[model samples]
Target: MELSTLKDAFDRASKKQKVSSSKVQEVIDQVGREIESAILKLQSVDSDQKSIFIDLRNKLVEISPMSQLEGSQKDLHIGLSKYARILEKHFNPDISKAYRNVDFDSHTVNQIIATHLYRHGLSDLGDFFMHESKEPSVIANAALKLQFLEMYKILDAMRSRNLEPALNWAATHRDQLLQNGSKLELKLQQLQFVEILQKQDKKQALAYVRGHLAPIASIHKVEIQKLMTCLLWAGRFDQSPYADELLSETHWDKIIEELTQQYCSLLGHSYESPLSVAVAAGFQGLPTLLKMASVVMAAKKQEWQEMKQLPMPLDLGREFQFHSSFVCPVLREQGNKENPPMLMPCGHVLSKQSILKLSKSSSRAFKCPYCPLESFVTQCRELHF
Candidate 1:
């Protein structure tokens, strides 16, 4: 039945002597429970309960006039207003689409607008009512459009706090906006910015920064700070003035050390066998003092070949001695003591068969099966296979 007609009938029934007020209250309570139950069901990942909840809430509001006693009329009106807002906040878009061609009575339109504004805020109504005032039809259309926007904007804003609700909404509603042009416009701007940056036109880059900051600076302080940092990092601005304020002494020291080490490593030999041997021997063999010495030596030599080549599990199988960098013939699963083998960084083992295959696969470069590291069999190749 139409909401208006249903409400009219209930209003008349409440005033009739034949219908008890208790029975009217019973129906209202039952419908309210149904509305809540539908809401909970809609929270699930696979629910299609929007229509059910809307129907129940509509019935509840329609019966409110008949069910509300003398002392509860104000409370009942407030409850109806809350229901309208909840439905507009959550289910209005679907309701609008479903009844797109149908004419709405004033009471239904008023309920939908009140609900949408109460739940979604009023910012969204401006676009839909650009050509019309707050008349019933205009308000209904605006409210529907606002609901559609809120459905996405609200969920997007909530993503950092709770991901599941947004994920479920996207899964269900993304297809409906497949032809939407909003994302396409955003992508175009990103592409244009990347192209301009690639051209290395400093004049154009500054202009772009100015354009963005003019509008965004007042609205987003954190974003403005990040933008300025990026400009400084790219050498577009003088960073010396803010260096002490932005970076700690420890951070500056670490940065200098890292850059110096990298410069040295790139200039010198690729690997250091002695350093690898010391590390592979075990923590006892490569004490903190020795490790520090190795770090200094590698920095001086500008190399890291030895450190990168060391096996992931240096103390594999207690069979090999400290000086040896060869594979063992035994294979053992984790937690097994007998014939124990060590797992490599690549997740492959140095089993007798596996080691043999690796040795023969490439003369210069072969990657481990479990991890991607260039490796070659140096010693004990003949003993393994």
Candidate 2:
């Protein structure tokens, strides 16, 4: 609601500003025209110079261009002042009150920044940062730079409609890609076949189908059949029914994403750079942390930076969730090394401490907290996140 109000205020201020500027420009143009006319009259008038000057001065006074400009400027200033007040009311500029001083390993932070740079195809900047930081030995993922450089080279070729490099890489990693349930090789070949068909070269397209696509034709019958059908349209494939599916630029984007995923998988890495994910997660969580720091921690006179666990749970989106976590229903506590989650034989989970308390130190059986089934503490197994 606040954001909507702020936006409305901004729009009003912008519209007023534009109107004022237009009014000022109109006044200036009118004044300029009057001055130009007076100049022309003065050049032509040889006998009535004093009379001409009096008439020009009267014309300027009648228009009152300075008054008009001042009115417009005043309106603009009032609108801006109101907008500034609204901004001040809506936003808190001093965020330092929410800050907490925590000790972090400088080397680890530098490595993360350097890795992020390299992952984004900024090897030169990464190298410069490392050299300047005097952490040349901290380039632990230097090999990743070369791998990402090669990936960028292939992506660059793909942007120019050249598929050779990508095709070669896909073919070389065929077995590994297949093992990962990736059909990138077939997709690349299908694109190549389409490119051939687009040239109206039925013979070459058929030959490509026979040599490059025939082996994979058995499992991908439907896709291969679609490609075969495109041969009928030849050069006019853009007008064909399959044109929307095969010729869409989104196909290239999807293929590029798939190739990147497979490449990262082969390199034993996640498709998203870890540093990027961490930053995104942090950005999403910062607001909640700030609120907590200002309201809860400040009231309690506690330092959140010195605590290992947060006072409250942060509700992040699914994309930031990489693993499962368990909170014991009995004790209402999260699983940890000292109090790990224990799965009961009744298919209910509880923290180890909860189980111990319920079963009287494994000496007696107790009913499950979630179910009526009885279970011994010895039957409960520890669960790892």
Candidate 3:
């Protein structure tokens, strides 16, 4: 089923819930006000018409009944239940097989999840899970935890306009960061210099520029010139010619994110945790796969589980594109070690198996299916990606 279908059901259920609650609340409030007004009237009425109190109580009973509220609640519950059933009908609960099919120790899975949670500051949840699972107090990758902890502390300090922690870290890891093609140190130093200039400390700012900005001047000459100009209008940096040099809330956030990405890259950890990446990719791909699964079930083909190749490409954006892509045009299958991609003379590519089959395994050159050029199997070069 399409997600839109399920979403429509959910929206309808939510609307029903909100409307029911609103009506119930209105009904209760109006009845309460009416009863209160009646009691007030009873207190002022003469004793000769003491029967007015009894009449007001009877009138209250007529205007408000507990059964009406119960009925509305029951109807709302029934509507929500219907939507739940519809949602459940489309839900596929067999997704565990994808992870289960991978040959990894289950205990290792629990450890990774617990460690990731702990690393993200969900200490209570992580500790509870670790204890319940009879895991050791410390994770096997305790060093990685300490590394992430130190990095997060620097990030937290950066949020408070303190770049010293990050500056110190960058200085310590200068060689490794440079080797990884990172300019994080220069970026951090530049920010610190800007922060100092914003304080109108002309002498101190120039000193900082000489010490920190001079070395990286060649690489970031234009950027440095812009920041140096901020020194001229130090008291009014916000209205300076290089107004962009003024740090923004969003700019600070970007720095933190970029630093984390670079830090993870240097340490060979994924920019995002492995579990987060996998879960995100799975969610992005699941709807299409689930629809395919439903179609396969309807046709009694079971193609979703048995098929070796998916029919379409997954456009998961640039962040997910870690390496070059070389899915063969002819076979519509991704290149693998055994059936690697072959770059033909015409610049068209195909899997090794597809080329062999298309060529009919003949000795003579065969026509290129995509173009006018013809090439023999021996002429096709293996492509790396």
Q: Which of the numbered candidates is closest to the native, going by highest lDDT?
A: 2
lDDT of 3: 0.77
Candidate 1: tens digits of C-alpha lDDT, residues 100-219:
133558655554444444334454453454325444445555555555454445334433333334334433443332333212212222223333444555567567657643543454
Give the alpha-carbon lDDT of every model: 0.44, 0.85, 0.77
Clashing pairs in 2: none
How big is the positional error of residue 179 in model 2, measured in Å on the Cα after superposition? 2.3
For model 3, the stretches where C-alpha displacement exceeds 4 angstroms are 1-3, 22-34, 37-41, 61-64, 92-102, 106-142, 283-325, 337-347, 352-366, 375-385
Question: Superposing all C-alpha atoms, what RMSD in Å does each candidate have to the true structure?
Answer: 32.3, 3.9, 4.6
Q: Pick the candidate with the highest TM-score.
A: 2
Better of 2 and 3 by lDDT: 2
What is the descending lDDT order? 2, 3, 1
lDDT of 2 by residue, 1-385 (tens): 1789999989989999999989988988888898888788878837477887798789889999889988888998999999999986555466575566878998888887887788789999988998887886544467888988899999999889899999999988888988889889888998888898898899999999999877678878898888888888998999999888778999999999999899888988788988888879877777677778777888888887777778888988889877657788888887888899988998888999998988886768899878889999889999877
Tens digit per residue, CA lDDT, model 3, 149-264 = 78878988998889999988888887787878887888788788778877889899989988877766887788777767778888677886556644677767887898898778
The alpha-carbon lDDT assigned to residue 378 of candidate 3 equals: 93
Query: Model 1: what TM-score?
Result: 0.17
RMSD of 1: 32.3
Candidate with more favorable, higher TM-score: 1 or 3: 3
